[model samples]
Target chain A: MATSTTRLPRAVDPNTVNGWGVDADPRNDPTYPFRDRSREDGPGMAWQRPPLQEPRVEVLRSIEHSRLPAVVGTSTPPKGLSGMIRRAAFRYSESDWRHWLMLLGADRINVVEGIFEDLARGRIPNIPAEMGARAEWRHNKLGLVRKVAIVAAVSAVAVALLRRRGRDDW
Target chain B: MLAAEYRGPYRMRAGRKRMPRIEHPRDALVRVTRSCICGSDLHLYRGMVPDTRVGMVFGHEFCGIVEEVGPEVEKLKPGDHVLVPFNIACGQCHFCKQGLFGNCHEANAEATAVGGIFGYSHTAGGYDGGQAEYARVPYADVGPTVIPDWMDLDDAVMLTDVVPTGYQAAEMGGIQKGDTVVVFGAGPVGIMAARCAWLFGAGRVIVIDHLHYRLDFARRYCPAEVYDFREIEDMAVFVKKQTDSLGADVCIDAVGGDAAGSALHTLFGKAMKLEAGSAIALHWAINSVKKGGIVSIVGVYGPTGNMIPIGNVLNKGITIRANQASVKRLLPRLIEHVQAGRIDPKALITHRMSLEDVSDGYHIFSAKLDGCIKPVLYPNGGQ
Candidate 1:
C-alpha cells in the first residue's frame, strides 16, 4: 500500500487572512450594545440596482423562466457525450421526469467516457484502487470473496453457453 | 443591490441585482446584514446539484433586519433583527404541522423530496437567496425568528443552518449515554455534529477528514479526537480499532456527495458526474458502525441514488436516518443551547468579508484557503 508521504499544508494564521475580524469592533456591529436598534431603521428596501452580468459561457436556463434570472452558473458548460445529453435534457421542462432521468443516464455515460479517456491517455486506471476494493477486501474478506466467486461463476456459465451455441451451429 | 451570483462551477461574483420586494401577502422584505457560504452551497457551486441554473443567488444561511412587511404580516414589524431558517417552509403544510419543516409540501410543490430552500437551485424552489442586500422572505410569520437580545449577530446567523443542522444530525443518531460516535467530514456541520454529540451523551467523539487545517480546527473547535483519513490505510478498520474492535455506536456522514478518499468514488461521483456526490463517507459510516448502530446523515446529496452499501446496512441492522435538517423544528432547542453558551457557534466563523468580496469568500471557502472554517458575508456592508 502506497501511503501519502507528502506533507499537508500547515494551519493558516487567522491574523493573516483578509476580513478576519471585520465584526470585532462594537462600534462597527449593527446589532451591538444590545439596546440600540438605530442601524436597523436606516434602510428600508431602497437601493440602486446592480448592472446585468454579461454571460461569458453558455448558461443553461430552465424552461419555466420567461427569461434568464439576474445571474447564472457558467462553470461546467455542456461538453462531450454527457454534454450532448445534458443539452437534450435541458430542452424539456425540469418538472418532467425525463429531464431528470436523462441527466442521471448521462452521468453514468460520463463515467464510462472518463474511463475510456483515462485509457486513451496511456494511463491504466486502477479499478480496484479507485473502487476502494483493497479496503473492502481487508474489512469484509468473506463478503468480497463471495461476491468475486459469484461473478466468476456467472461469467464462466455465460462463456460455456456461448461456446456450446457455436458448436451446435457448426 | 449587490449580491453574489453563481457564474458556474468553481465560480462566484459579486454582481448587481434588483432589490427584492414583498411579492406575497405573507412576505417580508429583509435587508440582509449577515450571510454565509454554507458547505452545501459548494454542491451547487460545483454544478453537482441538478436544476441549479445560472444567475441564481447562492445563500441559505443568513440573518437580517426586516425592512418592510406586507399587509398580512403580523408577528414581525420593520426594524426587527431576525435569523432566517434555511428551509423555506410554508407553516400551514401537513409536514410543517408535524414539525417536519424541511419537507414542507407546499414550499416546493415541484419536488417530492425536499422543501423550498433559499439561494438553492430551482429544484429547491427557485427562491433567490439572502446573499444580496435585500431578499423577499415568504411565510414571514413562520420561519424568521427574532434574534435574542443576548445572542451575538454572528451566533444568530450560525443558527440559520450550521448549528441546527449539526444538532439535528446528533438528534437523528439516537445517541445514547456513553455511546461512541464517529462523525465523517470535519466541515462546520461535521464539527458541530461532533460537538453536539457530546450534548447527546456520547462517551467519545471522533472526526475524520483529509484536510490538515480542518482536522486541526475540528480538534480545537469540536475538541473531539481528529484523524486524517489520508494517513489511515483503512478507515473502517481504524475506527473499529478505536472502538475496541466493536465499532462505534453511531456514525454520522457529514461529508455527503463531495467526499474524497476513494479514487473510484471521486471519478464516478464527482469528476464523472455519476452520483450526486461521493458516497465514500457514507460507505465508511455504514461499514464502520457497530451492528444495530445508527448512521445519521446531514450532508447534502442530490435527489438521486448513490452507490451506497445497502447490503452492509441490512446485514449490520444499522438504522439510517437522513434528511435536510428541519431547521425550524430544531431552532427552539438550539437557541437555548446557543444562549446557554453550551456551544459557541461564532467561534467557528473565521472569515468575514463584505458582499463585494463574496466571490473571494466563496473561493476561500471552496478551496479551503486561508484556513477558513466558515466565511460570513456582510451584504449591507459590515454589521
Candidate 2:
C-alpha cells in the first residue's frame, strides 16, 4: 500500500470540450459531437495505435512471478512438513496448485511442495551459480529434460489415439 | 490513493496504493467515482477463481471521471464522467467486430477461457481494476461510455455490469411469448434476469435461492414467484410440478461454484478441487429445464472442470448458452430501459461506503450481514 507522487491530469476548458462549442464551424458537421484533440496534434485518427509504455511496477503478491529453483525442490527447502500440510489443508488448496501449474505451463506432478512454500513465504529466491547447486536445481527441481520427454511422449500418444479414433469413426 | 487489496481468501485489506498512470496510448486514467463489490468479485475473494494473485485490486464494477486520456484516445477526454464495462475489448479485434466484446482477442493474451476483465486475475488479464482512487483503463474508447447528463450516477454505474449481465442472461434464454422461465439464484443478476424476462414476454418467472432474504428481494424487485431450495424436497421435481410436469421453458444458472446444497458436491467440488465448486446450481438448471429448453449460464465458474450432468442435457435435448455478458453490445437498449423507468437498477444498492472502508464492504457483502444486497464504494466519497 505505497503511494506515488504523480499529479492528476489538468482539465481542459469546460466550454470547448472535444472542439464542440467555441470552435464549431459552418463547414463542420453539427451532428458529430466533437473532434478528438489527440487527432488534431499527432498522427491523426486513422493510423493511431495504442503506444506501449514502460511496464507498470509489479505488485509483490504472495506468489512470485519468476521460477524459484533454490527453494522449489532443493534439499534445504523453506518450510516444515507440518507447515506444508497446513498450507495444503488451509491456505492454498489442491485446486489452486493445479490451476497455478496449468497456467504456468508446468506439469502438476512435477511441481514440488517447496514452490508452495516459496509462495507462502512471499519471497522468490534467486538461483545459485555453483555447479553442484545448479545441477541440483536443474536435475531435482525443474527436471527440464524429463518434462520435455513426458510432453513429447504425451503428444505422440495423443496423436496416435486421435488417428485411431478417426479411423474407427470412419 | 486508497484501494482494496487481496490479502488472501476471505481477507481483503483497504489501504493506500500507488496511483495508476496511463500505460498505453489507448489507456485512460479514471478517478473512480463509484465502484461496487460485485458478486463475481466474491468468487475471487473466496479463492474460487484461479490465478487471483495477492496484492491485486478487486473492483470491476466502477464508474469514474476521466482524469487523463492517452495520446491515441479519441472518444473520451479529461473531465468526462464515464462508466467502464468490466470486459476490456480492443475494438478492431475479430470478436469485438462481431459484437462478442466479452471474448476480445487482443485485450487478453491468455487462452480463451476468459477475455480481459478489469481487476480479475491474470487469467482474465493482469490489468488493475477501478477499486482504487485511480485505475488505468486500457482500450478506453471501446469499453467506456460517457454517463448521460440526465442519468443518475448510481444507475449509470450498474449499467457497466450488473444490469447488462442480468439483461443478457434473460436475453440468452431466448424466452418466447408467454414462456414460463425459471431463474436459479436470487442474487442481483438473477433478480435482474427475472425482471428482464417480463420484458421478453415471459408469462411467469420463478426464482430460487436458499437464502430467504435474497428470495424475498427477488420477489419484491422482479415480482417473480420465489422458492427457497432448502424448503423444496427436490428442485427438478418441484419445478416440473410447478410447470405441470413439463419443467419450465427455460432455466438460468446465476449461481456458479461455491453453491451450497449437497454435502457430497461441496466435499468433491470445493474441498477436493476435483471439479469447479459444487456444480449444484448448474446441475439443477440442466435437470429443471424442459426438453428442448435453453439453459443460460451467467454464473461465475472457475477455470476448470465441473461434474455437471451432461447426460441429462443430452437426453433432454437441452440447448446450453453461456458466456460473460457482452455489456457494450446490450448497452443501448438497456440505457433506454433504465431511462424509461422500466428498470430501477439502483434499487438494489443496500449499502454505501467510502473506498477507505472497502474491506468492511467486502466483509458485509460476503457474510451477507446487514441485509446487504449490493454495496457500492465511493472513491471520491460523494455518497
Name the 10 consecutive residues with the lowest summed lDDT in model 1 chain B.
Answer: B105-114
Highest-scoring model, lDDT: 1
- Which ranges in model 1 have alpha carbons more than 4 Å from their true place? A1-98, A101-170
> Residue by residue across A1-170, what tens digits does model 1's lDDT show?
11111122213223332222221222311121133344342333222212233445565555654544332323234567876877788777756667776766665565566567658978665544433344445445776698789999999999999999999999
Q: TM-score of A-chain in each prediction?
A: 0.61, 0.20
**Tens-digit lDDT track for model 1 on B111-164?**
446677888875676678989998888778889999999989999999999998
Whole-structure CA lDDT of model 2: 0.71
* Tens-digit per-residue lDDT, B109-144, candidate 2: 333456788888656666678888888888888999
| Model 1 TM-score relative to the real fold | 0.73
DockQ of each: 0.02, 0.03
CAPRI tier of model 2? incorrect
Alpha-carbon lDDT, every model: 0.75, 0.71
